[model samples]
Target: MNIHIFQHAPLENDTGAINHWINKGNHKKFYTRLYADDPFPSIDSFDFLIILGGPMGTYEEDKYVWLIKEKEFIRQAVNAGKKILGICLGSQLLADVLGAKVYKNNKKEIGWFPVTLTPDGRDHALFAGIENSINVLHWHSDTFTLPEKSIRLLESEACVNQAFLYETHVLGLQFHFEATPDSVISMLESDSESLSISSDSVQNSEEMLNNLHYSGKSNEILFTLLDRFLAL
Candidate 1:
């Protein structure tokens, strides 16, 4: 399989946790680092496209010039029937490109949280092995409305639209199922100001580090989702 990843920042790129899953199959993986001004690939260049998360908001096109082009590329990829995965900000971008409204949630989710799977998510083929409610790492404050023709998947206490399925080939997850200990640290280091130690929805750096085991379980669920997604 030919896989392409769109990374919004250096530290927030694909981590070893996801590498272990995607590397299981015979695949050639490529990257387009929008933070570094790397050129976007042609839609036909890859069979699958994975969009990684970043600190930037989806609507901040004036501050991040590449975001506009990135959304367009994602839209084209979706239309082309490419199997795609979008994480956090990538999910917001996907929702925006698909005509969904992206906005700030009432609370920012920045720690370990449980996501309850919707009825469709529980019965969905892509989430075959995933449980109805699972604790996953959350670092995003923005949430999106479900796109047209999309099935709502997961919901958390702070975010209603935690995950969504756009057709059979497109998946968007608000939480970071692919987060590793290192990636979590990188995120904290890069955007520490966003963390609120006293907030009900946020966890401190120490708390985040101590609960690294949650990431392992999340990654297992991610692997299952990826396997089922690729099989289709």
Candidate 2:
């Protein structure tokens, strides 16, 4: 498969389960580094598109010019029926492009948190290997409403809409199932200001680091989802 990745930040690239899948076969992988002004590829060039998380909000197009172009790229990909996976800010982008409202949640969710699959999600093949509820990594202040005609998949204590599925081809996740230890550290370092804020919803850098084992189980779920997605 010809897969293309849209990486919004220097530190927030896909790793762990995603890298494992990418290295599994002869499949080609490509990337567009939006932070460094890397050129975007045509929608037809890739069979699968994976958009990574970033610190920026979806509405900050004025500050990040590429967001406008990226949205258009996502729109074109959806129109073309590309298989798409979005994480965190990437998920918010997908929601907004699909005409859903994206905004700040009542509280930010950082570190490890539990996410429960909705009935639709539990029954869906995309989550076949995942448990009904599991702790996954979280690091977002914003949440999105379910897109029109989309199935609400996951929910958390701090965020109601942790995930959504738009048709069979598109999946959006607010939490990071693809994050590695290095990537988590990168986030803590890059967004240290946000981490400094004290709240019940937030976890300290040490706490986030201590729970690396959660990703082991999360990566298993990720691989299950990816296997199903690739088969589609």
lDDT of 2: 0.88
Give the per-residue lDDT digits (tens) of candidate 1, residues 66-144: 8988988898999899999898988898999999999988888998889999888888887776678898899988899
Taking the tens digit of each residue's C-alpha lDDT, what string does model 2 give over 60-157?
Answer: 98999999999999999998989999999989999999999999998989999899999988888778766799899999999988999899989998
lDDT of each: 0.87, 0.88
lDDT of predicted model 1: 0.87
Superposed model 1: Cα runs more than 4 Å off: none
Once superposed on the true structure, which residue ranges of model 2 sit more than 4 Å away at CA? Answer: none
Colliding residue pairs in candidate 1: none
What TM-score against the true fold does each predicted structure earn? 0.95, 0.95
